[model samples]
Every structure is written in structure tokens, then in C-alpha cells.
Target: MLKEKVALITGSTSGIGLATAHVLAQQGINLVLHGLVSATEGQALANDFIAQYGINAIFDDADLQDVASIERLITKAISTMGSVDILVNNAGIQHTQSAESFPLEKWNAIIAINLSAAFHAIQFALPAMKRQGWGRIINVASVHGLVGSVNKSAYCAAKHGLVGLTKVLALECAEQGITVNAICPGWVDTPLINDQISAIAKQQDSSFEQAKYQLVTAKQPLPEMMAPAQIGEFILFLCSDSAKSITGAALPMDGAWTAQ
Candidate 1:
């Protein structure tokens, strides 16, 4: 049922979002890719998908922080691809600091991109989804949404909010043939977390591998870090007919992190 359907994924230029795009494209889904990359780079990635998957693809660098730009993004996707059958709200930013010392600007930016952008994207995409009587809305939330960590107040807050939003939207669209859910993944071996691992390595005077082990083992019962493709595969499963009944869930792919 997903073949030839259009999916719009935000923050899709790299990391988990990019992995999800690849999974969807491979399923014969047309794509509306969004990222912060330059237009040329974004278009090249879209072209690559088209060439490799023989699927339609387009790229847009919409500013998620701006409501107008996000609206335009959804509008353009619908106009170009007919409808956004899958909406992945994966764009996010993080700033770590004590709650007391967190910069207001950083807090606002995080909330805007990580949380509010998802809200706006959902609002704009729901109409098209409702019209078709089917949609898959996946929010790439984090384990932080279910639990918490020090120096990650804003990130936790936004992720928690996203999970809550997932539930509400799911209920609202449940009978309407839309499944809204969040994927709460633990550490995925993505470039987005590379700097953090490197910093841990420096602080502990250890190798990157050693630091990565320490980091993952600290919270996850399973020390192995997840791969971006694993999350992509999970998402693909959620988009299938078998998963049509699994809605309003913040499913954790987090090595049992929150299990403790």
C-alpha cells in the first residue's frame, strides 16, 4: 500500500532521517526531503535517490523554525507529489546545560525546531491525510522522552512533548485511518552523536570506542548502539498494514534504556 505514496521527511539530509528516507524510497515511495543543506547538495541527494530507487524525489530546505516556511513546505509537497502519505517529524536541535544556566535563545530554538515544527507540520499535513483516509505520522522522539538525563533539559522537554503530541494526534486520527506514533531510540551510531562521543573520549582520556562503550553501557542494558538503518526498518514496519493498529505509542528502540 505504501508504493508510489509520497512521504515528506524533515531533517532528512543526514543521520536517522536520511536512513528513513532511503528505506521509504526503496519501498517505492516518492519523497519530499527537507534539510538544512545547501540547495545544490539537497538536490543532489534527491537525484541520487531517484537514480538508485527509480522513485520520484524532491528536496526542500525549509526553515522549521519559521511557520511560514514549514507551511510552504507542506504545500509544495502536496502540489508536487499529490499528497504527503507519510510525515516524519525528525528535525531537531540540542543544547546541553543546567536548567538554570540554559540560554533562553537556545531553549526557544530547541522548542521551535524539535517540538513546534512537528506541530506545524502535522497541522498542515493532516488535511491531505484526512482526504486520503490514510497517513503515517512518525515522530523520531528519544529515550529522553520516556526518561531523562542531566544537562539535557530542553531536549528532554521537547521530546516528551513530541511523544504527548503523538498520542493526541493518534487519537484524533485513529478512526480516520492515520497512525501517529513516536520512535524513541537510544544512541544510534549517527554523525549527530559523533561530537558527543568524541568529547566523552577526551574527558575520559580514552579511545573513541572505549568512550562509546562507556556511554552506551551507562544507560542501556545492551551495550551495543543502534544503527540508523535499524530505526529506518522499524519505521518501515510501522508503515505496513500489519501495524495499522499500533497507534499512540512511543515505541522505544532504546536497548532497554527506559526499562530500568
Candidate 2:
């Protein structure tokens, strides 16, 4: 049922978004990959996907901070690939500081890209989905969406808002053959976590592996971080017919972080 369907995924140039795109492309879904990369660089990734997966793929460098750009992103997806059957609001930026010390510009940028962009994308994509009578909207919220952490006020607030938006949209689309859900993942092995681990190692004069262990075990009971591809697999499951009944859930793939 997923074959030939078009999926629009923001932040698809790398990390979880890229992994998810691979999973969906392997299933024969055409893709509208979005990121901040240059068009030439983005097209190279798109060409690679086509060569390896034999599916249609295109790239867009839409600025998620701009509502007009986000609307155009959805428009381009539908115009270029027929209709956006799947929408993944995955583009996000993060800045960590005490709430009182947080820069107002950083806070605004974080909220714009992380929360507001998703809203605009959903608004534009919904009409196409409504006309087709089937759609899947997956928001890649963080574990912070479910819980909280020190010095991450803005990130937490935006992700928490994303989860809330997911629930409300799910309720509104419950009878319309559409499902909206959020995935709350703990530390996934991405460049972002790698940088944090590197800093921890430097600060404590510890080995990389030791720093990684300390990092993951501090909050997550599981000592190892999840791979980006693992999150991709979970997302694929959410897009399947078997998951048709699941909606509005901020499902945790956090290795028991919230369980604590």
C-alpha cells in the first residue's frame, strides 16, 4: 500500500530524517527531501537514493523558519510528486541554556523551526490528504517532549508543544482516515549526541566509550544509545497499516528513560 506514495520529510539531508527516508524509499515511496544544504549537494543525495532504491526523490532547501517557505515546500512536494501521503516534521534546531539566560533570538529561532514550521507544513499538507482520504503525519519529538531536563528550556517547550499538537490533530482527524503521532526518542546516536559525548570526554578526561556510557546511563537505564536507523524502523512501523489504530500517542523509544 505504501508503494508509489510520496513522503515529505524535513531535515532529510542527514541523521534520523535521512534514515527514515531510506526506510520509506526502500519500500518504494517517492520522496521530497528537505534540508538547509545547497541544492547541488542535496541533489547528489537524491540521486544516490534513486540509484540505490530505484525510487523517485527530490530535494528542497526550504527555510522552515519562514511560513511562506514551508507552504511552498508542501506545494512543491505535491506539484512534483503528485500528493504528500506522508509528512514528517523532522527539522529542528537546539540551544541549551538556563531559562533566565536564554537569548531571546535563540528562543525565537528554536520555536520557529521546531514548532511553528511543523504547524505550517501540516496546514498546507492537510488539504491534499483530506482530498485523498488517507494520510500519516509523524512528528519527531524528543524525550524532552514527555519529560524535562535542566538547561533545555526552549527545546523542551517546543517538543512538548509538538506532542500536544499531535494529540489535538489526531483527535480532529480521527474519523478522516488520517493519523497523527509523535515519537519521543531518548539519545539517539547522531552527530548531535556525538558532539555532546566528545565534550563530556574532554571535560572529564575520560575515554569516548566511558563518556558515552555515563551520558546514556545518567537518564536512560540502558547504557547504550539507540541508532538513527532504529528510530527509522520505528517510524516505518508507524506508517504501516498495522499501526492504523494508533494515533495521538507520544510513543517513547527511550530505553526506559521516562520509566524512571
Residue-wise lDDT of candidate 2 within 1-260, one digit each (tens)?
Answer: 99999999999999999999999998999999989899999999999999999999999999998899988889989998899999999989999999999999999999999999999999999988999899999999999999999999999999999999999999999988999999999988988888899999999999999999999999999888899888888888888999999999999999999998
Q: What local lDDT does model 2 show for residue 179? A: 97
Clashing pairs in 1: none
TM-score of each: 0.98, 0.99
Q: 1-260, model 1: which lDDT tens digit per residue?
A: 88999989999999999999999888999999999899999999999999999999999999999999999999999998889999999888988999999999999999999999999999999998999899999999999989989999999999999999999999999899999999999989988778889999999899999999998999999988898989989999999999999999999999989888
Alpha-carbon runs more than 4 Å astray in model 1: none
Cα-based lDDT for every prediction: 0.94, 0.94
